[model samples]
Target chain A: MYQELLTGLLNGDIRSLARCISLVENEAAGYESILEQLPGNNHTKVVGVTGPPGAGKSTLVNALITSLLEADKSVAIIAVDPSSPFNFGALLGDRIRMGQHFNHPKVFIRSMASRGALGGLSPKIIEVSDLVKAAGFDYLFIETVGVGQSEVEVAGVADTTVVVVVPEAGDEIQTMKAGLMEIADIFVVNKADREQADIFAKNLRLLAHTKHQPGGWEIPVIKSVAIQNTGITDIIHAVDAHHKAVTGQHQRQLILLADRAYQLIQHKRMKDINKQLLMSEIQQLLEQNSFNLYRYINESSCFTQRGKEGKEA
Target chain B: MYQELLTGLLNGDIRSLARCISLVENEAAGYESILEQLPGNNHTKVVGVTGPPGAGKSTLVNALITSLLEADKSVAIIAVDPSSPFNFGALLGDRIRMGQHFNHPKVFIRSMASRGALGGLSPKIIEVSDLVKAAGFDYLFIETVGVGQSEVEVAGVADTTVVVVVPEAGDEIQTMKAGLMEIADIFVVNKADREQADIFAKNLRLLAHTKHQPGGWEIPVIKSVAIQNTGITDIIHAVDAHHKAVTGQHQRQLILLADRAYQLIQHKRMKDINKQLLMSEIQQLLEQNSFNLYRYINESSCFTQRGKEGKEA
Candidate 1:
């Protein structure tokens, strides 16, 4: 069954691709084998669109998708919602936002939940995107809720990352600037039709231009009314230009690859230990007067003397 | 020096207490000794105040501190900002918000920056709060920015968690519900003087009452205009009530302690390895094309066969 799904995924069968993605999402049995067989280095330009909630990320993504489709590029979107419980609410909202391209043959969109585990989201996104990339799309756009920490993780998987903000996001801009400055390849001041749009755009441009980014690439702050489909062409242009400039930066690529590897390996190391079981064990241990977490971990199989076991393996 | 600080902490000497907290926050050498020496099982109530930016958390905290002081209770406030660069910017903001209590003899306030290491903040908060509890304060208040995953973590350290939100948070209230509901022991609809305040408070009460908490204690939603000091006393009353209600829930205490221990152990396991070193090693491995992260991690001392090393040590 896994082999059939793998073949179907490789053959660009949507049903097979969807089923495989679900298996990966659920971490179902045989998922590891599927990941091991995934084809890498597809040269698919993964563009990350991230910003605060209500930054119209979905609409901007929809507009960006329309433009990419116009450029004769096949696009696959992984819309990531940082909400927990893995419910259908956020997915429904994202679907409505990008409803225009629901039937387009060249476009595919998927919504994901964060699943509430630390260091878990990145590897999951990378694995799913790998499946999508293996299916032969020219461009992959990963749209994430650009609150805290999520954007930084999403940056690892994307060649170019676009941070979207609105005119009314005055206070958030300040709070987000510290973290967002380092990861953003391009900045978009969306909702340019709203009040304070010009001032917000100006402020963003000043901030972006003053920041000294490596690779001699100047981070551009583009103004857009994504709902009305204005300024998206400029965003696409910036993404392409930035991609071209960053292509020769071997050090940057090394860092990105290292980050990807770090999360992937961390996930693998943690895969065997069931957190639920560990919690129960820890609870039992806590009942004892001398329960120290470090001592317990040092004694547990999770961090046990692996040298002997590792050597044997 | 560590011994002296530990002695001072136990004796409730303010200078020694401050120095020890700094040591723990910096994770300096000998800080672990100080943590190990910290007094446990103090009757000090640790209350966590968390909410989105602009939710008036600092102001609410200040009001609560004033009320606690009026009740003849000594209070210690630890303001944790989940921003990087670990600089003085956010600390200054927090200080200004709580400036009125700067010279109050019974009030102790300190600001913290969330240094960018994953899973670092929780352990640090727990350590600092431990120090504060050791100092014999009647109440310890921890205020954190409630944008993302940070609040859930901060909740682990608090016996009763107060989540503050303003009426203007229309859509965000819904989005934050899933995460906030699980952690909030008391909800504060601050800025109750504003439009829709009554409705927002009613909605919050409805939501809070509907959620099935582990403890039979029903979460109370209080309305407050914190700046005006309106409804602040009711918040204090609710906190005291919740604290009294949950004091006998041994299972809840076990879960909280388990979370604390998990973060501490995780930090300990990750402490010795430098991220830069790991990245460089991974970079070299990635150059070989067939290099996978799992193989590299398994080979590294970070996850090496600990059994051999354990016996030798």
Candidate 2:
């Protein structure tokens, strides 16, 4: 079934792609089987775009998609919006600005709600991005909800993260102070037609000059009028340049690969142990109104020294 | 040790209170010892105040403290601020605004950094609140980092949550749509001296009238000019009224007690389990490269089953 789903996804069937993504996002019962059968076709260049609200992220994404399509590249976009706490439903309206790209056959746009997930990206976003890649897209863009420190985490998960900013979001340098500067492979000053755009761009460049980035790559500050599609071609070129530079740098690639591998193995073993302990602990808490179930679980687990300490103490 | 710490806290020693709080916030090595010895002396009414930034929350808190102090009541305050993600340090400047109360023996204010905690409240906030209660405070107020949804969670952990808002925050009604209204025991339309305060308050009152609140409690919209200390007495009276109504209503009190018990149990159990699992998983992830660590941990927990299952199939 998993192999069949992967084959269907690679065949460019949107329905198959959607189903697989839903499965991945929902962690549907057979997700592991499907993931196991996924072809290791890492052709897609995943770009993550994130910034504060009103930074014209969606507009910039639309412009980026236009450029990618002009180069005959198939594109997939995942726009994440914060979910409503009461109903756990996402407004998913961040992509409303990108309606023009709706009918474009080569552009597949998916809107996801962050769903109370603290990490700016939804838990299933990585899985769904993989599904999009499996569906034969050349570029996958993941956009995060526009607030908090989680944007850096989103950037870390993607192959490349594009940090978006506008002119009037407080002092231009102060924007860098909030952890956004370090994550950007490419810094975009969106709404560049606005007043202070040049000043903001200069300030960003000066800020970048002071910091020594890993991999010895310079963080380029590109100005763009996303709505008018100005400097978009240059932005695309910069993105391409980053893709090439990072892919060519063996050391960075090795580090990323090692990080990804480490994440995967740790995830698997913990998942196996947690599945057995979590529900029982939750039930015990409900029944007894005590957090001691964890101590009980720790005592039961063969690997925990804390369990031995608990018994001895 | 926990009993000694509690005794120190009750004696109003800042050093002991700080030490107790540090244990709670960090889940420090001796937390279990501290928690185990805590007596059930919850005499302080926990009131949570939250809203969007620039909604005059700190000013409102300032006004509320003055009103409470006028009634000869002792107040303990915890102000949460967003921490710098890079340094994990908080600015801790909000307390500066409430400096008038610094010299007041009856008012104790502490600023807490979110400290990269996922929830708006740090893990040890409840424990700290407990300490404050044991220390003989009449009121304990928790002010959250004013990001909308997360603030609601902070409010939930309190006995009565007062949502503060201003008129110019655009679509005053829409601000409530962010789930602030549901959690609010009382709503304060602060900065009433501003142009649109009356209209905003009326609209909020109308909205409250239309909505069916649990406990059948009317969420009063009190218009206040915190700078002038206007309408503060009424706000405090409203809060006291809320406390009385809840305490008088048997069902409501039971529900609240059950909720608190559940939270206590959940925290205790999860902290234990999380400590054991997090260390091993962090270690394993450091060692391996193939596993999806996030997925493993998220899927391993029963709490995420519905969310995970919804995606995987």
Candidate 3:
């Protein structure tokens, strides 16, 4: 069964890719075999598009996909709103034209629900990105709501991060500067037709210039009216330029790959422990008059130390 | 060394408590022995105070502590700012009087630095809270910035959560309702002397009644001018009332204990893996033309599953 799915995914079957993602997301039996056989190295450029609420990130991403499509680049998008669970994408519902790309042969869009963990980004996101990249898309766009620690975490996954903001986002920009300054490679001053757009763009450029990126790529603040489809080509050009400039930066890639590996290892280590079993065990443990949590964890069979089996602890 | 510290901590020594927490946070060698010996069950109430920036959470917490002190109850405060990393508590710096409690015999406060992770709450916070609880304080206050997913997570750790908001927080209240509704056991309309404070308090009361909790306690909306120290007594009363209502809710506690245990297990499983080791390993792996992440995780010794030793995956 795993072999059939792996064969189809390698042969560019979209259904197989979707099925594999579901399997991984649910941690279905034998998912590792499918992940193990995936291609090792690929040229798929992962781009992250993130911004505050009402920042027109979706519209900007839609325009980005449209421009990429003009070049016949296969694009897959992963939409993960930082506030997605609580707000339920109420902000992105009308803004994202993701539904419009449903029947498009070259496009694949996946939206991640938080799995009830409001801890910014999901743990599986890095692993899922690896899986998605193996399907051989020319580019992958991970779009997310720029709240919590997501902006920084997404920067870890994406080759380039594009921060979308509007003319009225002056205050928000000031508040989010620490994270935005660290991660933003390309700044999109979306709704450039609005008042003070040029001023915001200039301020963003000043902020971007302060970051000493190891890849030696200069950050650019592009003014784009995504609603009118203007400046899409210029934005695409900026993405290409940044991509070219960072191509040979091996240490940066090494750091990114290592971070990804660390997360995968963390997930695998935590794979078998079940919450339901934990509940039943605790229910039994709490029956006693004294219930020391630390003692319980130390004595628990699940957490039994393999290396220190004979140690004094 | 662990035995001496554990004895001192059990005797209600403040210095020992601090030292012990440091050891746990650092995961010092043989620290598990200290944890394993902590008292099984104790009667200490953990209260969570969370709200948006400038909602006067620290002030409210200060007032709460002052009230508890009047009753001669020992208190420990763990202040975790959700946006603490980026802002560096620029908002809470002058607002929090954590320094004032340094000389107070009955009060202890610790501020978390987020470990540079902007993820809402740190995983160690739970274990640290357990450490604090074992010190035999009459009450523990966990004060956190109510943004991100913290408000909900804190609710899991706390016996009762007091959500503080100002009269001007109408918009933020609306945006944060989904999370706030689930977690808030008490609402503080702080800075209640301001205009529309009464209306906001009334609206919150209506909202609170919407939740159906297992404890069957009425969620109270308390009006407070925390700066002037008014309403502190009433807030304490509400907290006591909540403690009384939830006293026998065994199933509820079973869930909280299970959640805490699960996090402990996860941390233990992931304890041996190091990022520096991962980077060095990845550097070696990346030298080849291809390095599949899934293959690396599978073949790596750290994630070798004990239960599935003979399996194919």
The lDDT of each candidate is 0.74, 0.65, 0.73
lDDT tens digits, residues B92-144, model 2? Answer: 34567788898788888887765343211344565567667767788988987
lDDT for model 1, please: 0.74
For candidate 1, the chain B TM-score comes to 0.89
- TM-score of the second chain, each candidate in turn, equals 0.89, 0.79, 0.88
Model 3: lDDT of residue A303: 38
Tens digit of lDDT per residue, candidate 1, span A1-313? 4888889888777778889999988888767677767664466788998866667888988998988898898889998876554224665777787888977888877877654543235478878988897777888899886344567678888999998877754354455465576778999988899778998788877877867877888999899999899999999889889888988587888778766765665455444445676677866775665544434544565443331133211
Best by TM-score: 3
lDDT tens digits by residue: candidate 3, B58-145: 8788877888888899999988754434555455573346566656888888876444331123567887777788888999998875
lDDT of 3 by residue, A1-313 (tens): 5888888887768898899999988878777777878888788888998766567778878877888888999999888754434465465573346577767889888877644331123666776787788888888998876344465578888998888877753233454455566678888888899778887788878878867778678888889888799988998888888888887678978888877776666555555555566677788888888877876666666433441231233
How far is B217's C-alpha from truth in model 1 (Å)? Answer: 4.7
Ranking by TM-score: 3, 1, 2
Interface RMSD of 2: 8.9
Distance from true position, residue A153, model 3, in Å? Answer: 3.9
Please give the lDDT score at residue A45 for candidate 3: 89
Error of 3 at B133 (Å): 1.5
| Model 2: CAPRI class | incorrect
Give the clash count for each candidate: 5, 23, 2
Ranking the candidates on DockQ from highest down gives: 3, 1, 2
State residue A288's C-alpha deviation in candidate 1, in Å: 6.3
TM-score of chain A of 1: 0.88
Provide the DockQ value for model 1: 0.21
